[model samples]
Target: MLFLNRADAGRRLATRLTGFAGPDTIVLGLPRGGVPVALEVARALGAPLDVVVVRKLGSPLNPEYALGAIGAGGVRVVDTDAMRALGVTAREIDSTEVRERAELERRTVRFRGTRAELDLAGKTAIVVDDGIATGSTARAACLIVREMGASRIVLAVPVAPRDWIARIGGAADEFVCLETPAHFFAVGQWYADFTQTTDEEVSAALATTRVT
Candidate 1:
Protein backbone atom coordinates (compact mmCIF):
# COMPACT_ATOMS: atom_id res chain seq x y z
CA MET A 1 0.00 0.00 0.00
CA LEU A 2 1.18 3.52 -0.83
CA PHE A 3 0.68 6.51 1.44
CA LEU A 4 0.29 10.06 0.25
CA ASN A 5 2.35 11.33 3.17
CA ARG A 6 3.00 10.86 6.82
CA ALA A 7 -0.26 12.51 7.78
CA ASP A 8 -2.20 10.20 5.48
CA ALA A 9 -0.37 7.20 6.83
CA GLY A 10 -1.09 8.23 10.42
CA ARG A 11 -4.83 8.58 9.82
CA ARG A 12 -4.92 5.08 8.42
CA LEU A 13 -2.92 3.67 11.29
CA ALA A 14 -5.18 5.39 13.80
CA THR A 15 -8.20 3.45 12.51
CA ARG A 16 -6.66 0.18 13.63
CA LEU A 17 -5.79 1.68 17.03
CA THR A 18 -9.25 3.07 17.90
CA GLY A 19 -9.61 0.44 20.60
CA PHE A 20 -6.66 2.08 22.40
CA ALA A 21 -8.40 5.42 22.65
CA GLY A 22 -8.88 6.46 26.23
CA PRO A 23 -7.65 8.82 28.95
CA ASP A 24 -5.03 6.32 29.98
CA THR A 25 -3.57 5.97 26.52
CA ILE A 26 -0.65 8.22 25.59
CA VAL A 27 0.81 8.60 22.12
CA LEU A 28 4.51 9.24 21.58
CA GLY A 29 6.03 10.01 18.20
CA LEU A 30 9.65 9.74 17.34
CA PRO A 31 11.07 13.14 16.53
CA ARG A 32 10.78 14.83 13.12
CA GLY A 33 8.99 12.44 10.76
CA GLY A 34 7.11 10.48 13.36
CA VAL A 35 5.68 13.58 15.00
CA PRO A 36 3.28 14.42 12.18
CA VAL A 37 1.93 10.89 12.02
CA ALA A 38 1.61 10.74 15.80
CA LEU A 39 -0.21 14.06 15.88
CA GLU A 40 -2.97 12.52 13.82
CA VAL A 41 -3.10 9.44 16.02
CA ALA A 42 -3.24 11.53 19.17
CA ARG A 43 -6.06 13.59 17.73
CA ALA A 44 -8.07 10.54 16.81
CA LEU A 45 -7.56 8.85 20.17
CA GLY A 46 -7.91 12.04 22.24
CA ALA A 47 -4.62 11.17 23.88
CA PRO A 48 -1.82 13.42 24.97
CA LEU A 49 0.99 13.63 22.43
CA ASP A 50 4.69 13.63 23.25
CA VAL A 51 8.02 12.98 21.66
CA VAL A 52 10.13 9.96 22.54
CA VAL A 53 13.72 10.97 21.90
CA VAL A 54 16.19 8.20 21.20
CA ARG A 55 19.61 7.90 19.61
CA LYS A 56 21.36 4.89 18.14
CA LEU A 57 24.76 4.15 19.61
CA GLY A 58 26.85 3.30 16.58
CA SER A 59 29.96 1.19 16.77
CA PRO A 60 33.22 3.10 16.99
CA LEU A 61 34.83 1.14 14.19
CA ASN A 62 31.77 0.98 11.94
CA PRO A 63 29.62 4.02 12.52
CA GLU A 64 26.79 2.59 10.44
CA TYR A 65 26.55 -0.45 12.69
CA ALA A 66 24.44 0.21 15.80
CA LEU A 67 25.62 -1.35 19.04
CA GLY A 68 22.27 -0.40 20.58
CA ALA A 69 20.43 2.77 21.55
CA ILE A 70 19.93 5.32 24.33
CA GLY A 71 16.80 7.23 25.29
CA ALA A 72 15.64 9.85 27.73
CA GLY A 73 15.29 9.22 31.50
CA GLY A 74 18.63 7.44 31.68
CA VAL A 75 17.41 4.53 29.59
CA ARG A 76 20.03 2.55 27.73
CA VAL A 77 19.97 -0.68 25.74
CA VAL A 78 23.15 -2.44 24.74
CA ASP A 79 23.78 -5.63 22.85
CA THR A 80 26.34 -7.30 25.08
CA ASP A 81 26.77 -10.23 22.74
CA ALA A 82 27.43 -8.00 19.76
CA MET A 83 29.85 -5.90 21.76
CA ARG A 84 31.86 -8.95 22.72
CA ALA A 85 31.82 -10.27 19.17
CA LEU A 86 32.97 -6.91 17.81
CA GLY A 87 35.60 -6.62 20.52
CA VAL A 88 34.10 -3.27 21.52
CA THR A 89 35.59 -2.16 24.81
CA ALA A 90 33.66 -0.75 27.72
CA ARG A 91 35.32 2.61 27.23
CA GLU A 92 34.23 2.67 23.61
CA ILE A 93 30.67 1.90 24.54
CA ASP A 94 30.67 4.59 27.19
CA SER A 95 32.03 7.17 24.80
CA THR A 96 29.48 6.32 22.12
CA GLU A 97 26.64 6.46 24.61
CA VAL A 98 27.80 9.86 25.87
CA ARG A 99 27.65 11.34 22.37
CA GLU A 100 24.27 9.81 21.58
CA ARG A 101 22.83 11.00 24.89
CA ALA A 102 23.82 14.53 24.04
CA GLU A 103 21.93 14.37 20.77
CA LEU A 104 18.94 12.83 22.49
CA GLU A 105 18.81 15.68 24.99
CA ARG A 106 19.11 18.26 22.22
CA ARG A 107 16.23 16.70 20.29
CA THR A 108 14.09 16.47 23.39
CA VAL A 109 14.53 20.16 23.99
CA ARG A 110 13.86 21.02 20.38
CA PHE A 111 10.59 19.11 20.25
CA ARG A 112 9.10 19.64 23.69
CA GLY A 113 10.73 22.93 24.73
CA THR A 114 9.80 23.82 28.33
CA ARG A 115 6.87 21.44 28.57
CA ALA A 116 7.31 18.85 31.29
CA GLU A 117 7.34 15.29 30.02
CA LEU A 118 4.00 13.51 30.29
CA ASP A 119 3.86 10.82 32.95
CA LEU A 120 3.52 7.31 31.52
CA ALA A 121 3.00 5.62 34.87
CA GLY A 122 0.28 2.97 34.65
CA LYS A 123 -0.63 4.19 31.20
CA THR A 124 -0.64 2.55 27.79
CA ALA A 125 2.22 4.17 25.90
CA ILE A 126 1.64 3.93 22.17
CA VAL A 127 4.95 4.49 20.42
CA VAL A 128 4.36 5.73 16.86
CA ASP A 129 6.81 6.08 14.07
CA ASP A 130 6.62 6.83 10.34
CA GLY A 131 8.05 3.43 9.52
CA ILE A 132 10.53 0.83 10.65
CA ALA A 133 13.78 -0.14 8.98
CA THR A 134 16.28 -1.82 11.26
CA GLY A 135 13.88 -1.42 14.24
CA SER A 136 16.68 -0.47 16.62
CA THR A 137 15.21 2.94 17.41
CA ALA A 138 11.72 1.53 17.96
CA ARG A 139 13.05 -1.16 20.26
CA ALA A 140 14.89 1.44 22.30
CA ALA A 141 11.72 3.52 22.49
CA CYS A 142 9.78 0.57 23.95
CA LEU A 143 12.55 -0.09 26.47
CA ILE A 144 12.56 3.56 27.46
CA VAL A 145 8.77 3.68 27.81
CA ARG A 146 8.89 0.60 30.00
CA GLU A 147 11.57 2.20 32.15
CA MET A 148 9.27 5.20 32.52
CA GLY A 149 6.72 2.89 34.23
CA ALA A 150 4.26 2.38 31.41
CA SER A 151 1.97 -0.53 32.31
CA ARG A 152 1.58 -1.46 28.66
CA ILE A 153 3.68 -0.61 25.62
CA VAL A 154 2.46 -0.70 22.02
CA LEU A 155 4.83 -0.13 19.16
CA ALA A 156 2.86 1.17 16.16
CA VAL A 157 4.03 2.20 12.74
CA PRO A 158 2.55 2.98 9.34
CA VAL A 159 4.73 0.54 7.44
CA ALA A 160 7.54 -1.94 8.00
CA PRO A 161 9.33 -4.95 6.64
CA ARG A 162 7.42 -8.23 6.55
CA ASP A 163 9.60 -9.74 9.28
CA TRP A 164 9.52 -6.68 11.53
CA ILE A 165 7.84 -8.53 14.38
CA ALA A 166 10.74 -10.94 14.62
CA ARG A 167 13.11 -8.02 15.08
CA ILE A 168 11.11 -5.94 17.58
CA GLY A 169 8.33 -8.07 19.06
CA GLY A 170 9.98 -8.57 22.43
CA ALA A 171 10.19 -4.87 23.16
CA ALA A 172 6.49 -4.16 23.63
CA ASP A 173 3.23 -5.70 24.81
CA GLU A 174 1.44 -5.19 21.49
CA PHE A 175 2.26 -4.08 17.94
CA VAL A 176 0.24 -2.30 15.25
CA CYS A 177 1.53 -1.92 11.77
CA LEU A 178 -0.52 -0.76 8.77
CA GLU A 179 1.53 -2.45 6.11
CA THR A 180 4.32 -4.99 6.11
CA PRO A 181 5.35 -5.55 2.54
CA ALA A 182 7.56 -8.51 1.80
CA HIS A 183 9.59 -6.56 -0.76
CA PHE A 184 10.14 -3.55 1.51
CA PHE A 185 13.45 -1.85 0.96
CA ALA A 186 13.09 1.54 2.59
CA VAL A 187 10.38 3.56 4.32
CA GLY A 188 10.46 6.32 1.72
CA GLN A 189 9.60 4.08 -1.20
CA TRP A 190 6.04 3.54 0.00
CA TYR A 191 5.25 7.24 0.30
CA ALA A 192 4.23 9.45 -2.58
CA ASP A 193 5.71 12.52 -0.92
CA PHE A 194 8.36 11.56 1.59
CA THR A 195 9.74 14.98 2.35
CA GLN A 196 12.00 15.31 5.34
CA THR A 197 10.11 16.64 8.36
CA THR A 198 11.45 19.88 9.74
CA ASP A 199 12.00 20.84 13.37
CA GLU A 200 9.52 23.68 12.96
CA GLU A 201 6.90 21.23 11.72
CA VAL A 202 7.43 18.99 14.70
CA SER A 203 7.19 21.86 17.15
CA ALA A 204 4.09 23.19 15.45
CA ALA A 205 2.38 19.81 15.52
CA LEU A 206 3.06 19.39 19.22
CA ALA A 207 1.87 22.90 19.99
CA THR A 208 -1.34 22.35 18.06
CA THR A 209 -2.06 19.18 20.03
CA ARG A 210 -1.19 20.78 23.36
CA VAL A 211 -3.55 23.68 22.80
CA THR A 212 -6.46 21.54 21.67
Candidate 2:
Protein backbone atom coordinates (compact mmCIF):
# COMPACT_ATOMS: atom_id res chain seq x y z
CA MET A 1 0.00 0.00 0.00
CA LEU A 2 2.56 2.54 -1.03
CA PHE A 3 1.41 4.14 -4.32
CA LEU A 4 -0.84 7.10 -4.95
CA ASN A 5 -1.72 6.12 -8.53
CA ARG A 6 -0.62 3.99 -11.43
CA ALA A 7 1.72 6.70 -12.77
CA ASP A 8 3.39 7.17 -9.42
CA ALA A 9 3.73 3.45 -8.98
CA GLY A 10 5.39 3.13 -12.41
CA ARG A 11 7.93 5.87 -11.67
CA ARG A 12 8.93 4.22 -8.41
CA LEU A 13 9.21 0.82 -10.02
CA ALA A 14 11.18 2.28 -12.95
CA THR A 15 13.67 3.82 -10.53
CA ARG A 16 14.32 0.44 -8.96
CA LEU A 17 14.84 -1.12 -12.41
CA THR A 18 17.59 1.31 -13.47
CA GLY A 19 20.25 -1.38 -13.57
CA PHE A 20 18.59 -3.27 -16.44
CA ALA A 21 18.52 -0.42 -18.96
CA GLY A 22 20.08 -1.33 -22.27
CA PRO A 23 19.56 -1.44 -26.05
CA ASP A 24 18.17 -4.94 -26.15
CA THR A 25 15.65 -4.45 -23.36
CA ILE A 26 12.02 -4.78 -24.45
CA VAL A 27 9.07 -3.66 -22.29
CA LEU A 28 5.91 -5.73 -22.59
CA GLY A 29 2.92 -4.15 -20.90
CA LEU A 30 -0.17 -6.08 -19.89
CA PRO A 31 -3.13 -4.11 -21.01
CA ARG A 32 -6.39 -2.88 -19.35
CA GLY A 33 -4.75 -1.65 -16.10
CA GLY A 34 -1.07 -2.27 -16.66
CA VAL A 35 -0.62 -0.09 -19.74
CA PRO A 36 -0.33 3.20 -17.86
CA VAL A 37 2.25 1.92 -15.46
CA ALA A 38 4.11 0.13 -18.24
CA LEU A 39 4.20 3.32 -20.28
CA GLU A 40 6.17 5.07 -17.57
CA VAL A 41 8.68 2.28 -17.22
CA ALA A 42 9.20 1.96 -20.97
CA ARG A 43 9.83 5.67 -21.19
CA ALA A 44 12.26 5.72 -18.30
CA LEU A 45 14.14 2.64 -19.39
CA GLY A 46 14.36 3.88 -23.02
CA ALA A 47 13.23 0.51 -24.23
CA PRO A 48 10.76 -0.73 -26.77
CA LEU A 49 7.19 -0.90 -25.41
CA ASP A 50 4.60 -3.41 -26.51
CA VAL A 51 1.47 -5.10 -25.19
CA VAL A 52 0.97 -8.77 -24.32
CA VAL A 53 -2.61 -10.00 -23.99
CA VAL A 54 -3.69 -12.59 -21.43
CA ARG A 55 -7.28 -13.55 -20.62
CA LYS A 56 -8.33 -15.21 -17.40
CA LEU A 57 -9.88 -18.64 -17.46
CA GLY A 58 -12.34 -18.04 -14.64
CA SER A 59 -13.80 -20.87 -12.61
CA PRO A 60 -17.23 -22.06 -13.63
CA LEU A 61 -18.61 -21.92 -10.07
CA ASN A 62 -16.96 -18.63 -9.08
CA PRO A 63 -16.45 -16.53 -12.18
CA GLU A 64 -14.22 -14.07 -10.32
CA TYR A 65 -11.71 -16.71 -9.31
CA ALA A 66 -9.01 -17.15 -11.94
CA LEU A 67 -8.33 -20.86 -12.15
CA GLY A 68 -5.90 -20.17 -14.97
CA ALA A 69 -4.99 -17.79 -17.79
CA ILE A 70 -4.53 -17.94 -21.57
CA GLY A 71 -2.28 -15.88 -23.77
CA ALA A 72 -2.69 -14.85 -27.36
CA GLY A 73 -1.99 -17.59 -29.95
CA GLY A 74 -3.22 -20.20 -27.41
CA VAL A 75 -0.58 -20.19 -24.66
CA ARG A 76 -2.15 -21.25 -21.34
CA VAL A 77 -1.46 -21.49 -17.58
CA VAL A 78 -3.64 -23.41 -15.13
CA ASP A 79 -3.37 -23.65 -11.38
CA THR A 80 -3.86 -27.40 -10.97
CA ASP A 81 -4.30 -27.11 -7.22
CA ALA A 82 -7.10 -24.56 -7.55
CA MET A 83 -8.82 -26.55 -10.26
CA ARG A 84 -8.80 -29.70 -8.12
CA ALA A 85 -9.84 -27.86 -4.97
CA LEU A 86 -12.81 -26.38 -6.84
CA GLY A 87 -13.63 -29.62 -8.66
CA VAL A 88 -13.28 -28.05 -12.09
CA THR A 89 -13.62 -30.50 -14.92
CA ALA A 90 -11.68 -30.60 -18.18
CA ARG A 91 -14.85 -29.66 -20.08
CA GLU A 92 -15.36 -26.60 -17.89
CA ILE A 93 -11.75 -25.56 -18.28
CA ASP A 94 -11.98 -25.95 -22.04
CA SER A 95 -15.19 -23.95 -22.19
CA THR A 96 -13.75 -21.12 -20.11
CA GLU A 97 -10.62 -21.09 -22.25
CA VAL A 98 -12.68 -20.77 -25.40
CA ARG A 99 -14.50 -17.77 -23.98
CA GLU A 100 -11.28 -16.15 -22.82
CA ARG A 101 -9.66 -16.75 -26.19
CA ALA A 102 -12.40 -14.80 -27.93
CA GLU A 103 -12.07 -12.00 -25.41
CA LEU A 104 -8.31 -11.93 -25.97
CA GLU A 105 -8.87 -11.63 -29.70
CA ARG A 106 -11.22 -8.72 -29.20
CA ARG A 107 -8.66 -6.97 -27.02
CA THR A 108 -5.95 -7.50 -29.59
CA VAL A 109 -8.08 -5.89 -32.27
CA ARG A 110 -8.95 -2.96 -30.05
CA PHE A 111 -5.44 -2.28 -28.78
CA ARG A 112 -3.52 -2.94 -31.94
CA GLY A 113 -5.47 -1.92 -35.00
CA THR A 114 -2.86 -2.90 -37.55
CA ARG A 115 0.26 -3.19 -35.44
CA ALA A 116 2.12 -6.44 -35.05
CA GLU A 117 3.59 -8.13 -32.00
CA LEU A 118 6.99 -6.71 -31.15
CA ASP A 119 9.99 -8.88 -31.89
CA LEU A 120 11.11 -10.39 -28.58
CA ALA A 121 13.64 -12.94 -29.74
CA GLY A 122 17.17 -12.44 -28.42
CA LYS A 123 16.07 -9.48 -26.34
CA THR A 124 15.85 -8.77 -22.61
CA ALA A 125 12.12 -8.40 -21.99
CA ILE A 126 10.59 -6.66 -19.01
CA VAL A 127 6.95 -7.60 -18.48
CA VAL A 128 5.00 -4.94 -16.63
CA ASP A 129 1.72 -4.98 -14.79
CA ASP A 130 -0.03 -2.53 -12.44
CA GLY A 131 0.05 -5.00 -9.57
CA ILE A 132 -0.32 -8.65 -8.79
CA ALA A 133 -3.50 -9.94 -7.19
CA THR A 134 -3.44 -13.62 -8.16
CA GLY A 135 -0.35 -13.37 -10.41
CA SER A 136 -1.97 -15.88 -12.77
CA THR A 137 -2.32 -13.36 -15.61
CA ALA A 138 1.19 -11.99 -15.10
CA ARG A 139 2.66 -15.47 -15.11
CA ALA A 140 0.89 -16.20 -18.37
CA ALA A 141 2.41 -13.09 -19.91
CA CYS A 142 5.89 -14.10 -18.81
CA LEU A 143 5.49 -17.53 -20.37
CA ILE A 144 4.37 -16.06 -23.68
CA VAL A 145 7.40 -13.79 -23.94
CA ARG A 146 9.74 -16.59 -22.96
CA GLU A 147 8.28 -18.73 -25.72
CA MET A 148 9.10 -15.94 -28.18
CA GLY A 149 12.78 -16.40 -27.25
CA ALA A 150 13.52 -13.50 -24.96
CA SER A 151 17.09 -13.76 -23.70
CA ARG A 152 16.05 -12.72 -20.20
CA ILE A 153 12.63 -12.04 -18.73
CA VAL A 154 12.12 -9.59 -15.87
CA LEU A 155 8.70 -9.54 -14.28
CA ALA A 156 8.07 -6.06 -12.91
CA VAL A 157 5.12 -4.84 -10.94
CA PRO A 158 4.32 -1.92 -8.66
CA VAL A 159 2.94 -3.86 -5.68
CA ALA A 160 2.35 -7.48 -4.77
CA PRO A 161 2.27 -9.89 -1.82
CA ARG A 162 5.70 -11.14 -0.77
CA ASP A 163 4.62 -14.76 -1.08
CA TRP A 164 3.31 -14.39 -4.60
CA ILE A 165 6.34 -12.35 -5.61
CA ALA A 166 8.64 -15.06 -4.28
CA ARG A 167 6.78 -17.68 -6.28
CA ILE A 168 7.53 -15.79 -9.49
CA GLY A 169 11.09 -14.89 -8.53
CA GLY A 170 12.55 -17.97 -10.15
CA ALA A 171 10.31 -17.77 -13.21
CA ALA A 172 11.84 -14.52 -14.41
CA ASP A 173 15.53 -13.70 -14.61
CA GLU A 174 14.84 -10.58 -12.52
CA PHE A 175 11.91 -9.50 -10.33
CA VAL A 176 11.43 -5.81 -9.51
CA CYS A 177 8.69 -4.65 -7.19
CA LEU A 178 8.21 -1.57 -5.05
CA GLU A 179 6.05 -2.92 -2.25
CA THR A 180 5.70 -6.51 -1.08
CA PRO A 181 3.70 -6.08 2.12
CA ALA A 182 2.41 -8.99 4.24
CA HIS A 183 -0.98 -7.36 4.75
CA PHE A 184 -1.87 -7.88 1.11
CA PHE A 185 -5.28 -7.04 -0.24
CA ALA A 186 -6.62 -6.20 -3.66
CA VAL A 187 -4.12 -4.30 -5.86
CA GLY A 188 -6.54 -1.37 -5.81
CA GLN A 189 -6.35 -1.04 -2.02
CA TRP A 190 -2.66 -0.32 -2.35
CA TYR A 191 -3.35 2.56 -4.72
CA ALA A 192 -4.99 5.83 -3.70
CA ASP A 193 -6.43 6.44 -7.21
CA PHE A 194 -6.96 3.08 -8.80
CA THR A 195 -9.40 3.25 -11.69
CA GLN A 196 -10.66 1.02 -14.45
CA THR A 197 -8.67 1.51 -17.67
CA THR A 198 -10.85 1.83 -20.74
CA ASP A 199 -10.15 0.53 -24.22
CA GLU A 200 -9.81 4.08 -25.49
CA GLU A 201 -7.24 4.84 -22.81
CA VAL A 202 -5.26 1.76 -23.73
CA SER A 203 -5.29 2.75 -27.40
CA ALA A 204 -4.30 6.32 -26.59
CA ALA A 205 -1.37 5.27 -24.45
CA LEU A 206 0.00 3.16 -27.28
CA ALA A 207 -0.65 5.75 -29.96
CA THR A 208 0.98 8.65 -28.15
CA THR A 209 4.19 6.89 -27.28
CA ARG A 210 6.93 5.74 -29.65
CA VAL A 211 8.25 3.08 -27.29
CA THR A 212 6.98 0.26 -29.43
Q: Candidate 1's error at 71, in angstroms?
A: 1.9
Q: Candidate 1 — which residues are off by over 4 angstroms?
A: none
CA lDDT scores, all candidates in order: 0.89, 0.83
Q: What RMSD value applies to candidate 1?
A: 1.6
Q: Local error of candidate 1 at 144, Å? A: 1.3
User: What TM-score, over all chains together, does every model reach?
Assistant: 0.94, 0.86
Q: Please tell me which predicted candidate would have the highest TM-score against the true structure.
A: 1
**For model 1, how does the per-residue alpha-carbon lDDT over 1-212 read when each residue is reduced to its tens digit?**
99999999999999999999988999999988999999999999989898888888788988767778887778888888989999999899999888888888998888888888888899999999999998878887887888788999999999999888888868899999999998989999999999999999999988887733
Cα error, residue 127 of model 1, in Å, equals: 0.5
lDDT by residue for model 2 over 45-89, one digit each (tens)? 987678888777888987867777777666777778989999999
